[model samples]
Target: MTLFRQIYSLLFSLFLLVVASLGYVQFTETQSFLTKQMESDLNNASTSLGLMLTPALEAGDTVAAETLVNVIFEGGYYNNIKLIWMVDGKQQEWNNPIKIDDVPQWFINLNLFKTIKKESTITSGWLQLAQLEITAHPGFGYHELWRIMSNTLIVFSLLFLVAIFTARLGLTWILKPLNALSEHAKKIAARQFGPDMPLPSTTELKDLVTAFNSMSAQLKHLFQSLDEEVGSLRKKNLTDPASGLPNRQYVVSRLNGWLSEPSSGALFLAKLDWLEEVHSKYGYQVRDETIRLLAEKLVQQLNEITPSVIARIAAFEFAFLVTDVEHDQISKYLQTLIRTINQEISKAGCKPNENFAIGVAERVGQMKVSDILAQADNALQKALKDNKTFHWFETTEQQIFTREQWRDNLSHAISNKKFKFRWQPIQFCNGDGVTQRELYCQLELGDKLTHAGQFMPYIELLSLGSLLDKCLIETVYEQKLLERNYEPLAINLTHQSLSDSQFHQWLNHFLRNAPQVERMCFEIPEAGVYSDLESCTRLCNIIRDNGAKFGIDHFGRQFGSMSYLQGLRPSYVKLDQSFAYYDEASHNSELCRAIINVAKGLDIQVIVTGIQEKAQLERFNELKTDAYQGFIAPPENIE
Candidate 1:
């Protein structure tokens, strides 16, 4: 029970005990007082009757004494009366009977008042003649006792109710601060620094609130400071000082990583033809200003076209790595870059001959980083020799599948639900057992099955992301039998899948009565969430309400703001492979620590993926990662 309820219960019990005890005491005292008063009245009536009868007997008026006795007996003050007369040494007695009326037997039995009788001697001239006896009825006493009890019960009941209502009001007023403190605690868990609560009249709770506010302020300041420091360090190391674009190392690393993956890629190199002439005519400072201005314009135009990495490789040469795009798209992006640079220089009143020369090389398969760089350089030399502003290197081999053919295959696969999944175990960092299975989807092409990397790009291009997600959900549901022996399943969703309203509606309906739904988890890429945050949050809320957990995969890659997590509150976040596998430099360490700390404050779990090295796992364990998913552990099959 809550503390408030406990307090109310205790107060109510104490009130009941006090009221009951007071009622009992008052009832007993009232009964005793009434009994004594009745006894006194009976004694006085008996004494007075005895005196009056003595006078009549002394005067030899027996008729008068008998008349007086009969009159007193018929008055009903006494239950019975007796008169004894002495004549010639023989005694004669008269006795009257009594009857009880109008009172219940139970009430009479409970009151149990005793009958009071008084005996008086009758004399003639100081000699006893007969004895006059009177007995009092107990009916009156029973009525008085019952009345006192009823009044006491009524009064005490009303008092008890009033006391409880007053106590409730007081307790609610006093505990208001405690309720605010509880809500404050929830906000802190969500990584929100809320306003301070009002101080309570209760001293102890006031002190607690003071301390809690102090701690919250400190944590908020710490997280902000870390964010600023990490951002500054990342920009300093990866960006060129003059042009504010990525450095040579950053671009090359990204190019190498993307080339190794199963995606089409292109490398574009552009050279400023009049850099030496500008430096000779003007000065080095003027040349530097021109290069910076040209680089800014080129980056602005490239970003408007598509997402690409821009870098300054040399004093006059710039490079870009555009992955997962067709050769035509790369050529268009290059043409836009050249046109934007020339327009910007013309606006600066520069000569028409002082322009940019660009070269492009496209890859469909795995190629060495050195080979890509050399091919792009050779193309640039050809462009300069041919007196052309742009040149392209074409491949000699024909592709295995045309664009239309791949689209047809993916569309058919999604429609027919011809997709298969392989389950891989994700283990806890503390050496505990596996927590869940990460699913990898595959498609069959004729006699052989094609992996996701080769076909997912096509599916994305066809706008079939939602359809693929639906297929995966159905596959997981079919694994109900396997779920009995293994952990739950975690599936990744594409941006299109999360943005589709119909998919969300279907998912909600599918899981309405589905057994073991809590054992399912849906994961979305951090970069994908930026596409439509409103839709993403709505989808996440739907999944969460249905007893499934939401997670962010490839986290910290976009280097975006984390304010979205406050609303999403995902169950866990998986670090990107690049962040987890790279060496722990000072900047990287600071960045990792900041991410973990922010997640911890939000009460969200952190998982580091791609920790293939034992040393890397140890380092992450020291960083308090909740789980790891990589080749360190062999993939365990679900069935």
Candidate 2:
């Protein structure tokens, strides 16, 4: 039960008891007064009657005595009375008829009415009669007492109800602030610090709320201090204290957060290329001071042009996180910043004796932090290849780098047993079809197996995409190939893997050694592939050459042209649902039909995705598409 309801019931019960007690007291007092009054009346009547009959009794007149007895028995003012008299030691009495059931029997019994015969000498100026007798009854007192008790009970009932209503209002009003303060304290405990709520009018309760608010505010301040301290500690651990620039760990964390946001902004990747030469020419203090001066110089320039987060990711490698700038200007700004920094360094009498190289790569859509970092790293490497100090990441160069890194890392992770695999069952159509599974790989730490979605982007950002792909491929072949029935482990390949000849050779060698693994299929994201088709074709050919198949995931939505179909032949082509869904019925439906037809002519099986209803299934079946995949398929929820 609720608190208020319990209190209301308790208060109501107490009120009833109090009212009953008061009613009983009032009723008893009124009944006592009425009883005394009735007794006095009886005494007065007996006295008056005794005086009236004294003369008759003394004369010994029977007729007069008989007349007097008749007058006493049928008195007009005493219709509800009873009379009794004794003459010569013989008794006579009369009672008026009373058949009253208006009062209860128990009540009447409690106030029992009984006759008491009393004899006294009637005195007339010191003279005595033969005898005078009277009978007493409490009949009139009982009736009058009943009426008074009934009135008191009614009054008591009304007063009880009034008190109950007042108690309810008063209790709730008193507890209002206490309840609010309780809720606020709970919210503070949960760390939901915002504005305080309105308090009640009661002084004590209001004071409690005030104290609670003050405590919450102080706790909030303490937490803020702890946060700042933690941030400072982290900086001290991974930063060059003199320049206030990030060390290696700081660079890694920034890259991680940057990649966390989906390819929304641009970051500039620059390498110091020659910090040792500068330090060697200058003394320890001058070198330290020089690095600081360079850091300040970069900060000033970056701030002046556009406010950006500049960090020293490595001992000599620094990074600039720029706002979303036009793609072409990214390289131009990299050139400008390096020239400006070098120019500033020369102004301080430091000759251009040390060679510096720079690389620039911007965020790609849905790219992981590690992957973007890798892109910059790749850019830096390409700068070395061209014998130039700076180079932007071109698709062709990034591919070669991706493949080599994939092979190196895949070999490392697998030999060291760092690869782990997870599977998600793929539902086929309308929640009634047999389920198929897609297995993916992740790197395992002690007691932890992180999902690919968490750190795959980082692999590519650090230009380690190929290594991740190799890890996935090796784990699938070693474990899932013979251990599980989930065929065609849907491993994602980095663009870098596609261009590495050595990795492709290793794949072929492995497949040749295990011929049954020949049925393996690889999936490459369509958007990244179509970004540069020539590289896409080369990558596809290499995989097809190894007796393995390839499919374009998230395909047919974009980069769907005659050339894409003509160049690559896969075992199955999963259709992007843009062509197959219901909401596109009016305008985009025909475009979908066109895609299915194109795939059909090319002998590619089309698997339309995102089917939601039975009607869509019937239409796709009519369209003659093979292997429908959607939430409606079997899972009834997953697309």
Candidate 3:
């Protein structure tokens, strides 16, 4: 039993005992008083009758004595009245038996009443002539005793109920803090930090609440420290201390992984030609400082166009990669990088040598690492010989529409809601079945269906990311995916959408009213997360409060520490396809292992995506991946 019930029962039982005891005591005392009062009345009646019968008995008048007896007996207050006299050595007697019928038989049998009897002598002058006896009936006494008992019982019953109600309120009030503490404990177990509970009035409960709050605070601090440690370890392993950019090893590993597939990306090599001049004129410190500042500028400028990886590959060489880039975009990006470097050098009061020369190469189809490197080197040698600003290795492509035409088509599609959603199940490697589905949204432009990458750049440029996110939510709701099965439908949200306050409010309200908000999961890309972590975390918390899940897609691509995990506590982390490329190099394997270890330590689920081979799946199985998605499950279209 609960403490409240146990205490209540004990209290009620005690109350009943006290009430019964008092009832019995009151009943007996009233019975004794009534008996004594009846005896006194009978005594008075006997004395009066004795005086009346004296003269008659002395005058030998039996008729008068008998008349007096009959008058007392007919009053119905006495159970018996008798007069006895001696005549010529014989005795004459008159007696009356009780026959009163007003009281119940059970009442009389209960002994609530006691019979009272008394006797008095009949005297004439100084002579004792006869005796008179009077006995009192107990009907009046029985009625009084029953009335007192019934009243006492009613009063005690009311008191019992009042006491019980008060006890219930008291117990609830006392245990209120304990309930809040229980909820707090649950939040802590889920790795969520909830506010502390108010202190209770009872001393013991107050102490307990205080202790729990202390423990929660300590635990939060501990977890935060662990996050920082892990982040430091990650940064130390992958980043170059001098430039604060990823190290050469990190870049090469990433490049190898990216090249493993038929992906379209550019590899740009920018060799700083002024490093030697700066070392000779301004010392090594100034050269190192200039390089660091230039690295920062490059990241700030290039990352704005796209999420690209900038790494220091050598003492005077830097390499960067941007995926899915067109030829003109690569040329524009390199030109801007050279201009920015020159500007920074001039601003620093250094003799601005042609700060750098860049060699850009784009991969069209399956190519070897040595082939791409040789092409980039050949382009660099050409730029140096020709004294040109830069050199590019180009490939052929067919363009059907100009920039303006493509923009108009994309704008029209968004305005007309010409988007199709195809949800593909992410099968669990553990065989628990599919609890999540990946949403691939496609935009239809006239007769063509274009994927996200083809149109996202335009959408982002138009500042319609929030609108697109809203449309996706509405479309999913309209599809009624949850009506069939209540597993989570994962939707990808862009950085702009997560940072938009209007979108946050709209999503919060929408989720509150949506029937299957609990089965919804919003995925933010790993690269997108680095720019707006605070807002993203807040958004994540909001989604979680509404019973939805959040996760980071394309994980293990960033070289920064996974410190964000401590705050976001995403339901799962989906490793990038490159992380599954165990055959690439030992560093890639090490990086994947590090991420998995950190994720596992925090109890986060690890899912591998882009599994196109059974061999890769088997390797992942051996490494204990939580789930897998891609050609293994095969994409299925939703009607």
Query: TM-score: which candidate is best?
Result: 1
Write model 1 residue lDDT over 337-386, tens digit each, in one string.
77787786675566653556778888755687888888898888888888
Model 3, position 137: C-alpha lDDT score: 73
Off by over 4 Å in 3: 1-184, 192-226, 252-267, 280-285, 301-307, 322-335, 347-355, 361-382, 392-395, 398-408, 484-486, 526-530, 559-566, 582-585, 588-591, 619-624
lDDT of 2: 0.60
Model 3: residue 387 alpha-carbon error in angstroms: 2.5
Model 2 reaches what TM-score against the true structure? 0.42
Would you estimate the TM-scores of all the predictions?
0.81, 0.42, 0.74
* Residue-by-residue lDDT tens digits, candidate 3, 395-487: 575553566776787667666767887777887888899968988888777687766656665566567788888888887788786665656
* Cα lDDT, model 3, residue 553: 86
lDDT value, residue 341 of candidate 1: 70
lDDT at 299 for candidate 3?
A: 90
Candidate 1 residue pairs in backbone clash: none
Pairwise lDDT winner, candidates 2 and 3? 3
Error of 1 at 442 (Å): 1.4
Quantify how close model 3 is to the true structure by its C-alpha RMSD in Å.
Answer: 6.3
